[model samples]
Every structure is written in C-alpha cells, then in structure tokens.
Target: MQQREEKQLESALDSLIQRVNDLKSSIAAMIFKVENEYETLNWPQFLDNFALLSGHLTSLSKLLNHDKCPPLRNLTVLPLNLSPERDEQLAQLTEGRVTTFAHDLVPDYLRTKLEPMAESKMLHFEQKAATVTYENAQKQVAAYQKVVSNIWDIVSKTREEWEVESSSRGNTQQHSSVSDTHLLVTAIGMGKGLKPNPNANGAPGQPTGGMMVPPQGRPGSAGQGPIPPSTQTMTMNKTPSTIKTNIKSATQIHPYNR
Candidate 1:
C-alpha cells in the first residue's frame, strides 16, 4: 500500500511540475500584456496569481520529496534540473493534453464525477505550492519585476545627473572662455581726445553724442600720470590653465616627450 501511494504521489508531483511549466508559458502572454502598460499593471492581482502557482509547485516538489521537508542547505540545487530525462518525464506527466497517468485504471464512474475531489486536491496543492513557492522559487515574478524597476530607476537617475553635470560644465566652460576673450573698457585722461591719455589708465569714453574724450583726472589720482596702455594690463585677468584636467588627468607625458 505504501509503495502504491508512493507511486501515486510521484506521478502527481510529475504532473504538477509539468502544469507549472505550462503555467509559465501562459504567464508569458500576461507578461506581454503588462509590458504594454506597466503603469496600470495589476501587480497585486498578478502577484496573487503567480504566488498561488508557485505555491502549488513548491508544495508538489515538497510532497514528492516529503522525506526531506526541512531543506538541509541554504541553496538546495535540485538534482531534477540536471537530468533531462526526468525533466521530460515531468513535462509530459503534467500537461493535460499529454497526461499519461492511466486514468482508465480507476473506475469510469468515479472518474466521471470527481470535480469535488479534484477541486479539493487542487486547492490543497495550490496552498501547499504557495508555501513551497515562497521557500523554493528563488526568483519570483515580483522579484524579477522589482529588479527591472530598480535598474530602470538607476539608469534614469544616472542619466539625469550626468546631463545636469554636463550642462553645468558646458556653461561654466563657455562663461570662462567668454570672460577670457571679453574686454572691459576704462578711461584714462590724455592730452587730446583721439590719442592716448596723458593721465588715465585704460580706454577713453564718449563725453558727448558719438564723441570720445579723455577721462578727467580726479583730485585723489595719486598714481595717475602715465595714461599709457601698459597700466591697464595689471587688472585684466587670463583664463586658468587647469580647465582641461578631467580629459587628460590620467595621461602621462614623459620628459622625453614620448
């Protein structure tokens, strides 16, 4: 009797795994639908359905290997995945269209009216599966979706930060270059209006309508005698040399110029 029961349990397990695989395939269609509009994707509904399915699979696997219910290791690499023949058998046993579980062995009358028992067993399996699914299925659909969401968020945020920095750097560089090339005009007093100032420091300005004139000397003009072009050179600043540091910071230029 034990042997028979064992055989039945094994057969049921095989069928369950196969069904789960089919469920996985069906899930692809749902995934496609969700991908189209992920914002409105019914995550709770999807999670519930997926959890129910995984729970069933985990339950079946546990039932098949009931002797080892409390998994010994943190990473229980099922040997079933390593064996293609068993995998094929599992696929065949679970598919409703390809079920080879010999339903004819049971009485035809019992088979004809088994929905209640079948539903009960299904509910039981799903509940068990949910438990096992939580324990065994290392990567749930929820986990997968979370991973994708996190990656997208990271990528978007990184792009935004990079763009902001890039724009700021460009603006800074543009302002620096413009300031370097731009000239500021100041007036220095001179002997006449058109020529160099005999008293001021920089360029002269217009005293009247479209008329340039020498700047007037002040009472406190101590170092204001030359009005030479060289006096204005001290105030004008140049662009710093460290502007291109990032592009070639790591580069090495040998003494031999190699």
Candidate 2:
C-alpha cells in the first residue's frame, strides 16, 4: 500500500511539474514577444498565449489542491557532492574560491528572522516623501504668485507715476507759456507812447537836427559895464529871433527834414 501511494504521489507531482513548465514556457514566449517581436505580434497570437498560460495555471492549482499532494512546507536544501572537476568549474564560473553550494554561501538575511516593522517603515518613508513633494510644489506656486503680484504692482505704480508726472509737466509748461504771453502784451502796451531820444548822437552817415548858438555878448568885451535898461530889453527880444533863425537853418540842412 505504501509503494502504491508513493507512485500516485509521484504521478501527481509529475503532472504538476509539467503544468508549471508549460506556464513558464508560455510566460517566456510572451516576454520574448514583448521584448523582440512586439511590432509583429497580433491580438490573436497574444490571446492564444494568454489562454495557454491561464490553462496551465489552472491545472497547477488543481494539482496543488489534490488529496495526493503533500502539504507545502519549508524544505532543507542539501548540496550535491559534485566531482572535483565540476566543483572547480562552478567555482571558476562564480569567480569564488569555494564551491557554489557551500553552507557559508547562504546570505545572512535568509538565515535571520524578517522584521515585521520593516514594511511599515518603508510605507511611512514613502508617505513622508510624497507629502514633502506636495508641500514644495505648493510653496513654489505661492512664491510664483507673489512674484507676479509684485511685478504687477510695480508696473501699475510706474504707469500711474508716469501719467501724473506727464500731467504736471504739461500744466507747468502751459502756465509758463501763458505768463510769457502776458509779459509780452504788458511790454507792448507800456511802450506805446515811448519814443527814441532825438538828441542822442546819430550814427555815421546820418544827419542830426541840433545846432550851436553864439553867446549874447560883444566880440572883444570881456569885462564891460552893465548895459542900460533899454539896451538889455532890446538884446533879450532879439535873442529869440536869432535862435529861431539858427534852428530853421539846421532843419533845412538835415537830410531827414526834406
């Protein structure tokens, strides 16, 4: 009975192995198509590969659940006693001084217990990273908005100042122009009755109206006695006629009097 049971178990295990190999082959083919033949692969070929893989997986699942199958458990790995030549070849391939399957070749982590808190720590780190990135993005946006607002304010203030300065300058110019015009009008009005001095010396080539008159006295008398009343009256009356005669002669000689 023990031998028969072993045979049945072996058959079941063989079937499971065959199904797993089929699944592995189907996966490898799919990976090859994706990696190298993706451009040439059609929907039908992809669906066929998927269906084959799914069927193999279903078979493997059924076999694993079968009564004849043993319970899944950790199995001890025992190193094969390879020949010396084969051991040397494996050592050369791995670039190690010892055999590939030596007890010391196992990693320390595989021999130690897994820490339950490691997964939680990794999750916490990822969450913190995501939060930091989001906060940085928000800060950048706020800074950008502030800079834009400042630029807008500066532009608006500059425009307002320019307008105000331009208006003030225009008003000042207008006031100056009006004041100048008023001064010009006042000068014209005040100078209406004013004339050039006729007694002033004339420029070269111009005639003058002035003339020199002789003093009322004897030609050779320097200290003569006082004249009689009748003589003085006659001299005074004759002076106006003599002065008139000289002015008339000067006017006739001047070029402008013609």
Candidate 3:
C-alpha cells in the first residue's frame, strides 16, 4: 500500500512539472511583442491588453492544475538542478537552514507526509484570501473614504501669454492662465446642488451642478469629469482615499480618446 502511494505521487508531480514547462514557452511567445507598438490607441487597446493578461493567467491555471502533484516519483530527482553541492546552495538561497534528515525518518515518510504538506499550503492561501473579503458588498461599502488622489506623469506648461483685461476691477494685467500649462491636476468637489463658486477650490466654473475641478492647470479644463489614470498611476496609488463616491448621476464622459 505504501509503495503504491509513492508511485501515485511521483506520477502526479511528473505531469505537473512537464505542464509548467510547456506553459512557460507558450506565455513567452504570446507576450514577447507587447513592447512594440504604433500610434495612439483607444479603449480597445486596453481590452486587448486585458485579453492578453487573461490568456497568460489561464495558461498559469492550466499549469497549476496540470502539475499539482507531489514529487513522489524518483523522490531522489529534485525539482531544480541537482549536484552533490546543490543542497547547500539551495539552503543558502532559501536561508531556511535545511538539513537532510534520514529519508527513513518516517516509516515511509514520502508516501505519507509531503502530500499533506502541499494540501496544507493550499488551505493556507485560501484562508488568507478570505480575510480580504474583496467581494463582499458590505465590506466594500465600508471602504468608501473622504479624500481622493491622482497621479501624473508628464507636466507640460503652456507658454505664458500676456494680456490686458478691462473689467470692473480696472485695467489689470490678466494673464490668460490657460496658456500656463501643467503636467497634471487634482481637485475635490462636494455639493448637494449645481451652483458654482469660482473661488472654491472644489468648484469647476459654471456647470450644471455638482462639479469637480482638477487643481489649477490640468490636462483638460474644469468639470471634465474623471479620466482613467495611467497604469503607473494606478500602481502608485493602489490604496487611495475615496470621496464623493456613489454620485454616478453626476458622472460626465471625457471627450479626448483615452
């Protein structure tokens, strides 16, 4: 009975390792070209990128399913390059201070132990994920916040243009602030209605209602709504404060191609 179990573990591990190798090659071939590209793109490019990522992840799932067996076969044939000195090298890399105990430490330990170890690892990951509760709506509602954040890459300032304005405030030199360009802008808005006060940092000029103006000189003008931030920006601000959420009726579409 013990011998049979060892054989089963060996076979399973062999299948999994082979499957992982196959998947690595497929993923390399599929993704080697994403770096090369042409002109500007629209949302379709994002969809394409998502599709590509999904494909690779699927390959990963296939690999995981295909190879989830224990290294029971030869048991002597290790997963990585093996030499007399390889064990010491591995221990150094892991910093785990691994030492080879008697393979006979458990009467037939190979047939009885490693499989349960792998199963335990699987359970551990699942329990960790449960702690996050990312899918629970109530937990998500609690996640709403009071402040928002945005990231920016390039900031291009417009050439300063001088102009004179004849307003009730007299002949004051009103430089067209629009000409002074910038890389990015950020602002906040909160209101139960649409009237605007230009002086308010949150106001977006004269708009229909609740308005959000990116601070000072943003890529687009005021009340343009939100722009899907750049990927780098997402990484920089993964956990950000959320404010003025659940106001979907006030959402406006941006005109420029994202």
- Could you tell me which 10 consecutive residues in candidate 2 have the lowest summed lDDT? 205-214
Cα displacement (Å) at residue 82, model 2: 8.8
Return the top candidate by TM-score.
Answer: 2
Tens digits of per-residue lDDT for model 3, 91-194: 66435444333344223333544566798998998888778765774665555431121111111111111212224347556775753332122222233344
The alpha-carbon lDDT assigned to residue 244 of candidate 2 equals 99
* lDDT against the true structure, each candidate: 0.56, 0.72, 0.50
lDDT of 2 by residue, 1-258 (tens): 979866876787688778876887889889999899988999999999889888888888888888877654433434565233437676775456555454445443234443567868988888887777777979989999999999999999999999999989887743357777777776566643334557548653233433222344663488544455677689989999999999999998999975
Runs with alpha carbons beyond 4 Å of true place in candidate 3: 37-258
Candidate 1 to truth, TM: 0.21
In model 1, where do residues sit more than 4 Å from their true spots?
Answer: 1-10, 22-26, 37-39, 67-258
Query: Compared with the true structure, what per-residue lDDT tens digits does model 1 show for residues 54-156?
Result: 7766756665566633332332222222321223564565454432323342343224445787989998988987777554566676788899999999999
Residue 5 displacement (Å), model 3: 2.5
Candidate 1: C-alpha RMSD after superposition: 25.6
Cα lDDT for residue 69, model 3? Answer: 47
